[model samples]
Target: MDRDLFRTVKQGTRNQARLLYHRLVCRLPHLLAVTLLLVVAPRLVSTLSLAALWSEARANAAVLLAACAGCAAAAYAYAMSRPRPVYLVDLAGYKPGPAHEATRAQAIRQFGLAGGFDDESMSFQKRMMERSGLGEATHFPASLMSIPVDMCLQTARDESEAVVFGVVDELLAKTGVRAEDIGVVIANSSLYSPTPSFVSLIVNRYRLRHDVVSHNLSGMGCSAGIIAIDLAKHLLQVHPDTYALVVSTENITLNAYLGNNRPMLVTNTLFRVGGAAVLLSNRRQERARAKYQLIHTVRTHRGASDRSYGCVTQEEDDAGHVGVSLSKELMSVAGEALRTNITTLGPLVLPLSEQLRFLATVVLKRVFRADVKPHIPDFTLALDHFCIHAGGRGVLDELERSLKLSAWHMEPSRMTLYRFGNTSSSSLWYELAYCEAKGRIKKGDRVWQIAFGSGFKCNSAVWKALRAVDAVAVGDTGSPWAQDVDVLPVHVPKVVPIDDDEASYKTAAA
Candidate 1:
């Protein structure tokens, strides 16, 4: 054997031995490290006069090991705990009342507002007026009754198409995401359909690629916003990297019931015109610019029975008069829908405290036979912001009470209803904008959005804000409604009525 080769082999063996020793020591217990150091250190130190050096080294090694353990635990904890960013983005809205006024006036007359109907008609009108909170039924002159159902119907059709296009245009302009880039388009209109469905109108208008997917929801009611969001989530999950466009609106023109049917007449008193288009994408690049990320989506349908399903429906009487009627069973049916939604959503976003409270209530009510049961899960624990469906003042009030939310928490929804009436599915976005405009939302804040509609369905979506929206940047094109809002919490004292001013002014001018 060569002398050089033997030296090289010896050096390689020593290197391998050191590597094996290090690997073994790295896995040793904290106490074991101290034990090993104590057992070995005295031999390495070997002070001539110290016979008990090993014991002293062991005591010092234990303290050093404990310090090292604390640092190691902290490093491990920090590496495992890091925050993820959440984003929420709002798209554009389209206005509804662009139809000619003359057509609207004719619709009012043909619909029986100008003293055309008899006793049965008058009776039904009275009932509807009472239900809608429009005070007692009174005849309005032909000129006074203005909202033409026919013109509204026409506008509903054209406006829905316009809303869809406007959304597409906004997405392209704001995100620089072209129509071809949008993989799915989900457009929802509660009523009225033109020759080319609103979805097709958008695709054709933009000359989108032939393969783009499209869905049109004809009569899902206001809850269609979450329905679309859920659909978009599923599409995004399946299509790797994709963008989905969700547009929500209600077609009020054809939806108006002119007959003396009280249920249908309730719609005439409210329901303003509005539409919203939102663009959602699953791509990482797009998510950076996105305002809100879709956190969780839950949907529940109470269509298990005919009664449950037909709570809100169009009916025709024996006299051949058509109208939409509501069953006394509708409120219970809505509650069922809401119950189903909470069941599905509660486990997803609720905090541990809320979950425990909910579980305790269910257990106490069912198992223990307790005299008192706890309330349902604390929804406020799960969400800092809420954009509940603004279907009506009554609907908003019901949700606020059920959820134990504050008046300020429901202000956005109430204001949305006052401003836009009921824009059907698009109403949620309007409500969200109201919250943003008031500077109520903060970055990383969670928002709970819930909507209910005709399917006896309740749908919900949870969103977390990624950034604080600038107060001045927030826009409400219909801020005229805010003029009616009392800015302070306290209500002003009522003033005495005066009748002479209007008549006197007119008389003096004459």
Candidate 2:
């Protein structure tokens, strides 16, 4: 993002304007729903009158009026809340050293010989390590690169429950959040379906107050992180002055695909060990204490019936063999999903100029059918920084073009991919941390995070920094990873763009 863009947003109550716009946007859907009701209500009422149903007609009117009033009140309350993310903490734990890379290549080669090779390579692994400053671990194979069965909950049913609880314990220590104060708990694990479930394990482990609202989400892919954030946002509104903990991670052992399909290979090569716990609250008192504030969230899902939903999928063959696969058309599906998500999300956060441009194009294309072209989303207007989904270099390239994002706007996300490999759901947080390390974040700066998942889902969370980090957080072992990130490859370093098809690698001993 350009400094001028940030300056412009701050110049004349633009933040205030953006907030009002979002409040209205939130009500637009409900308003449209009610409008449909209005169109249908009169005719239906008259039809019922023929049956002498006067009381039912009056009751329907009352219900409609009440709903409209409630929506208005909710919108007003949200607009007045004025909550912003305090600071974003991106985790860089489980940094992949060199050994991980060799392991992956070995796995691919061995699997390929048995027709189990989806051609999952160490290319992404190498890029992730170099970007993250993780020297040798990038070469480690899936066997070593992946989390232990115990960690991803691959053991007995009880064991899986125990693993998630153990992680929650670590989370409590990291955030210093007590069990009693937590008003909401959201856990997203797409693979393993343990008995008591992921959320239940966390609540039980912490012995959280019995009244705490808990939600467990499964089946959603990497985008589950932001979906979890949205869920927390709503819970905050329902119970103000309460804490909500959002936990996101994939069960590596469960989702791991051992097959020869190319799409499945992408997953084996990209995903690695990672998990994150975020603390969110709408309470004014918690503002100064919170790490990151909830500015805004947008979720767009192409249903299971949509083409994009099958773009990235796992299925069993007619013979009953199970495996994950990525279609050659996955990128196109992702682009379409992004188009829908941005169309809905951009208007709420972007500036007047960008919105007008977008709107004008829509009008020209749809109404006049003029010889005008559609405009790519102007993300620069809405955010000072961006954590583009690090699904892959190809995915990033497509988004950069689609959103018209500058290279700097993509740096943190790219660097995050380099260091963390795709840590699945937690990758966005790590990318945000990279931006903070680069000294790009300032007080009141807006950060946009976009993540794509298996359902061909696009989920986005917009955050405004309330304060800058005074110093790097204690848990960020990747700090050393960021020390000389500008030049990159601080040790025996060699760097290249991930999209460079011609780039070659020379093996080095760790």
Candidate 3:
């Protein structure tokens, strides 16, 4: 009892100290100004008296006071003109219920029986999944294999509703923020949209206010999550004291590639069912309760280049089988996109020393025409954590090499891919949840989330944690990895052979 009381007292004291520090930091400019005035007031008065210029001194003092008043007014105006702080109050990832779980063997069996693929296609898909870095536990719709091409509407609606409702409901429940309070709604899904649109569906389902602004984004691919956040940030900046809800997801059932085109088949093996809903607020009242502050968002589009634009394209193959084809040039295009994105984001987040070095390298390369390669500023110097999109094994490997991230740093992306597969835009959120579940995030730590998408686009969102958060306290039960998080970072082999019967069947059919 005595030890418990002592511990409580110590914690209270620490909390008080933290409060005091925040107060001082917020009022630092005012404190400095007051200190300067106190230090100089006496000397100024003495000097004026010694000069025997009382009348002139009084006149000068009046002018000086007027100037100070003008300056204060200007400062207040500038402060008001600045954008309000945007906070991520809370976020939730949709973990499809047990009914949707698809084992690798199940996926193979269903594909075989569905008659969507020939022997060659089946073998290729099996090979792709084996090397795809996705585990047997990845979620897929029960109707995926059974849904006919003409009945795509059912699959689209079912998948969209399941993910959208699951994530938004969880987010609202966690934050206790009513749907009516959400003034802006932005929903992004690469493949599916009905007449009402996904955003309208959300607003209608949640019974949001009549005035709620809604937008539905499509064709934005895997990076759409960051893009949606960027859109929300802008909307919140323009409309003050309002809540914005951003939902990122992809309709895998509707977009699933069933064609024999090898490039297009890749998407089938990579993408899985997932979605994330994030609640952002610019309200001053919620600052203390918010989990993270949006520090920076940068987006770059290299679509002007023909190769970059064509790297990831959705179209019908020669046989009229529609699918998204990922070209071999995707990695190189993505690398260029990332390089361009980081160039814009570096100045805002990178340390002064790193910036100076990068600037020097640029100068040498451009001005002197030297054989100097431009430096990639060490992003680790600016961010405590990185949530790179878990698009695929090759994407993760390339990013790990490009960013100079260690195995420990790349663990979240790798593990998220293994657990959930590529959830399109929402993949970053799953990666972030992985970090949180592992207890890697801490107060004041800055996390950088970077994503690449089908527009030949790369985008980034940097977040600073507002307060300490424990994975347990946040309740990880809703996460796909919640049950097995403790046993994660497990070795996933580069390839796993298909069952002996399935292999023989494929060989005979060929």
Candidate 4:
């Protein structure tokens, strides 16, 4: 048995070596170029130094100079060919009125009675909501509990229009940019779309120019905001001096599951109505007025793996009620996705010290076959602020542990989850608003926003603050957290018990 195990291990090592060799062979051109510069170039120069070859020295010098010039031009072109700078000129988050705020008791009573959940399902949802870390102020659309169930469309429309119109108007007004000047309009929503599409609605409502390019992304879950930003960045690269308006939102009313499946039930407890609008410009003149400059965007998708692909998915339950389900392995899957994303992002943003340390560990393990644990780079050193996804309490806890982050570093995510629950793709913007409302973001500060979504995907966006923004400047009308900004960073208990009569009755029935 011992001999067989040793043989298996040796075979695995050989296979890995073969794979590495194939990869290196694919990069042979780059390796050959590097070898010419380091090895052949110096030897050629030295050989030309002999006085016997003085006559040929001038030709060799010209050849060497030409090679050097070619290399410099290639490097310059690679740098200049990169996408143009995309600036976040201004942004706004939708603030729902008091009528939309739903407390735990309210959700328990309203959803429990209206959703027609069985006693066991109600009990399970009650427990889930208690541990959700959401406050009593999370908003919900009025159409969520319509008696006839036919009002879902109207509810979705009302909710989407309110959020889209409010945030876009606020963004345009704040940036002083005309609607007609927006060259690109991208809107993403995880649920519900009217015939004209959300992007079309924005164009019509704002009277945007006929030539404005527009796209409406549907079914891309909570990470769609960053994905939209990535799309806009690419568009700006091709279309110079253009403005891209990205609206990220999720409509909960139509997507809300009225089923008994525990996984589906969790969505109803966590997701709430919210939206955000971000104005991105590639025009150089807008840089001085911009609030933040987009620096890096890294996205990782693990959909090929069955476990990750099914981690979060929308499917019909046994009774034919359709809803998005959160799998038991969601946290683990999300952690893996985040690891993949940061692995790519670390080299781009991490300081030299951290990069060297990570490189040393990787070299030791790969080349020396050292039995060393892989090091998680100190991302805090690379970013001043972190807006991790507010997917749920467990998601936040896992990220904190994986990234070795402190409580203060996680304040924005925590507070956003507490105030807004999981607003899907727009949650990161809400967290950013919270940071801004608290005056935590300073000029030149690097803010890193990470999001995990249904594709078992992790996406990250890094921004450098262009100018200082004071908390006072973030008024109640400007930010969803503005009204209670001063009272934030508050202690949110892990569990808030439901004390309403309905909850008591449900407990008695159970």
Candidate 5:
């Protein structure tokens, strides 16, 4: 036993010595290089004559001069080739009057009294309302409030005229931009398109120049605002030193679904009246006065796929009543669109370090076949503010969790939902307005405005603020939240379950 112990100890010592010898051998070149750099390098430098170094520099003068010239030329060429920046000079979100304000209780009582919805449909609407995160202050068009709702082109026109004129007047007033000076007008609405396009409506109302670039985009739902911004950006890029007006509105007075289709009825409970107008310019003179400079606009359209195209659509029910159907596949389709949009946008906006981390994760998951959860790139690192479209409470909830955003980051969207309900394409602007109203927008802050639309499209609009926006939380600043923004940043409960019993619902809504 003593001999065995002695042999084991002798073997362990031999193994340690052998390992140490190998380590020293492996490090020999590095040690020698370090010694030369620390000791021999200084002595060599001391021994070197100034005349020799001067001769070397003189010999390489032509090459050094040529390299510097080449670098300057390259920089000049890059500067000239850089894309012109698009500036958002000012923007306005329509604030409906007190007559338009519709509480959730009002919706319940009015819809119930209207007798349009059967008991089952009414019950579904109540449930949706309970979870919708809407406060008692959302608006509905006056046309919608009429006892027997007037569904006519005239009524729709009235609604559109109100939204379009309201926002445009405010925007024009704030910017002090003249009608004829407007070089381009791009208007977007999902459901209501008149014979004279919305662009024409703006043009005729403002008496814009005959040569003005005009377009009316239709059937592009809630994401249309970003899409309109994208369109305006392109137009501004081409039409140098010009102002472009982009109007986004959806006339919900025409959006009421009288049908009992459960899927279609969701619209009745969620959709509300709202609109926005934005002024964009590519003029160099406008930079100092601009609120934000457009950095990037990315749009992902999944309409080619049948499932995505049909996810949210207007169709006649079995009984021949027309309504918009919010399919079960809608969220999944939106998710797919959002995934594609963010992936494309990630490379543009994410910092180099973040991009590298995301790339490494992709490599690990795809190339290495490692067992790992899919990496959700931390967007908060790249963006200072997020104006996620407040389409509904569910959408906000899903994005908050998926994006790993804090409550502060989501406050704008949530408060918008609570205060304004779902304003469709203009909802994103309402959210942005909330931030502006709160004086949260600071100079150099990068804001990411993301929205999902009915063409099954996901879109992103990125901006960098020029200066801090003042807290315009009162009067008519064209912000829907301006009137009540001070009382906001309210604590919205995770779930406010309402009673299912019919009698209890009346009291709950009240």
Candidate 6:
């Protein structure tokens, strides 16, 4: 009883101290501002005194007029050069029908029937599926799910076209935007970059304008989605009064590895059928209708280093079967890339107090050569929501620890993973859709979307909600989370921590 009382008292004391410190940090900038004003007010008063400045001002009146005119001209030029704000009008994430769902038991049974994998490889996949944070309802491409599997260029096209059409049709329906009105079209698919690229396919199907600026990004990996968004943002800035359509997906049909190579099998269990289409408009009139406004984007690439470059590579194995190899160094490279990205992003989004703290840490380490640990900025203070890529369970687990995010902040990512597995480049969008479905996004809420992929690139897109995103009706055909999101915030079984050797393998796979 005495020990319990002491523990309670100590916990209360710690909570109070934490609260007090947070309040102080919140007000530090204001305190500093007041101090600065007090210090500078005397000098300003003396300089602006009529007696002191009257003679100087009259003597330099002509010079002052010329300086004012020059300043005005410079301001005008700067304003003209500023980029237009990109508004995310709306987005649609493709929801696969009931026929596409890949239940866990069914997947394992099919894996055994398909053959080629050794007993060890078979067990590896079984274990991975059990702890992969993917639920039974996640969809796989119909072509690949067949007992014998039919993976061909035609099947790949079938999968890609279905995803593209599903999301784009839903997006157009909700936004009431005509395909002809789309001035820019950008499509990204890491693998299966077919002839009539995704951009060309979208343009031809929608009968988009002949002059539409189109870009097809291939082999950019999962991070390519945000990279597409960043590209669209820049295009919208330069090409005023236009709508940009960004399509992100990964076609698993042709990329699935049939060999017994353990490292390559990771992709088979993780990736699934998913895609997302986003509509961005630079038109001033769309601001009222837009769901969110693009605030900032930061991308970090570590591919220059040999280790990072070789971390994720598509190559033929010794047996002559082609697949994307997962190197053990992948997680290490990703961590470095993430660090570089968030460091660049911190100043752009972190609050004044957090910025000052981060700045102090930098100065102490770089300038003063102090031994203090580098401070991890409190990103939660800056961002109201976080949508980290749902690559795998370990990826989400590591990020949750690194960022000190609460379970609530991670729910969307976790739920998305459970529901969709890893949709590669399109996973981040599905996570965002989850937030929208839950109505967790309020006006002025800041959201951070971060993803890393092949080329060892880490990318972030920051968005500010323009208005409260209305919660979705259960089973809305437009959303991937339609069937089960209402039942979500579902209980995901926690993965047991693995040994070092297994951990590295899982990390690289993630």
Candidate of highest lDDT: 6
**Candidate 1: stretches off by over 4 Å:** 1-88, 96-156, 166-171, 473-510
Deviating ranges (above 4 Å) for candidate 5: 1-81, 366-369, 476-478, 497-510
Q: How close is each model in CA RMSD to the real structure? A: 17.2, 12.2, 10.8, 6.4, 12.5, 9.9
Worst 10 residues of 4 by lDDT: 1-10
Per-prediction TM-score: 0.70, 0.69, 0.85, 0.83, 0.82, 0.82
Q: What's model 1's TM-score?
A: 0.70
Off by over 4 Å in 6: 1-76, 359-372, 496-510
User: For model 4, what is the alpha-carbon lDDT of residue 361?
Assistant: 66
**Quality of model 2 by C-alpha lDDT:** 0.63
Worst 10 residues of 2 by lDDT: 501-510
lDDT, model 4, position 118 = 92
Query: Which tens-of-lDDT digit does each residue in 50-158 have in candidate 5?
Result: 8976887689999888988997897687565556899999989988889988777677777765565677887888888888898888888877787756778899999
Candidate 4 residue pairs in backbone clash: none
Error of 2 at 58 (Å): 43
RMSD of 2: 12.2
On TM-score, the leading prediction is 3
- Candidate 2 residue 153 Cα shift, in angstroms, is 6.3
| Per-residue accuracy of model 1 over 1-510 as CA lDDT, tens digit each | 134323433443454466557657655555576898999888767753465665766769978788889979976875444222222345765543324222222322334533334555544433433333121111122222353323444555554555566555665676677778878888887666566778888888888789888888777877988888887777666665677878777655455555555555656655545678887777766656677887877788878879888998766755665656667777667776786677666756766677556556555755676766446567876688888887665677678777889877776676665445567788788777666656677888888888988867899999877777644231334322232234422221222122223323233223
lDDT digits (tens) for residues 1-510 of candidate 4: 335324433443454466568668766757887887898877877766666466675659988789889989987886676568999998899988888888888777776556558978888888898899999889888786344343457767888899999999899888889988889999999767678899999989999999998999987789999999999988999888889999999888778888888889999889988999999999999989899999988888989999999988899999999899888998878876876677667767777788667657666866797887666789898799999889999989988998999999999999999989999899999988888888888999999999887877899999999998778453567777868876777898888887775556465334
lDDT of 6 by residue, 89-189 (tens): 99999888889987776676566656566667767877888789988788888897786788889989999999999999999998999999999999999
Task: State the displacement of the C-alpha of residue 93, model 1, in Å, after optimal TM-score superposition.
Answer: 2.0
Q: Look at candidate 3 and tell me the lDDT of residue 316.
A: 94
Candidate 5 local lDDT, residue 376: 73
Better of 3 and 4 by lDDT: 4
TM-score of 6: 0.82
Residue 128 Cα positional deviation in candidate 6, in Å, after optimal superposition = 1.0
Q: List lDDT for all candidates, in order.
A: 0.63, 0.63, 0.83, 0.84, 0.83, 0.84
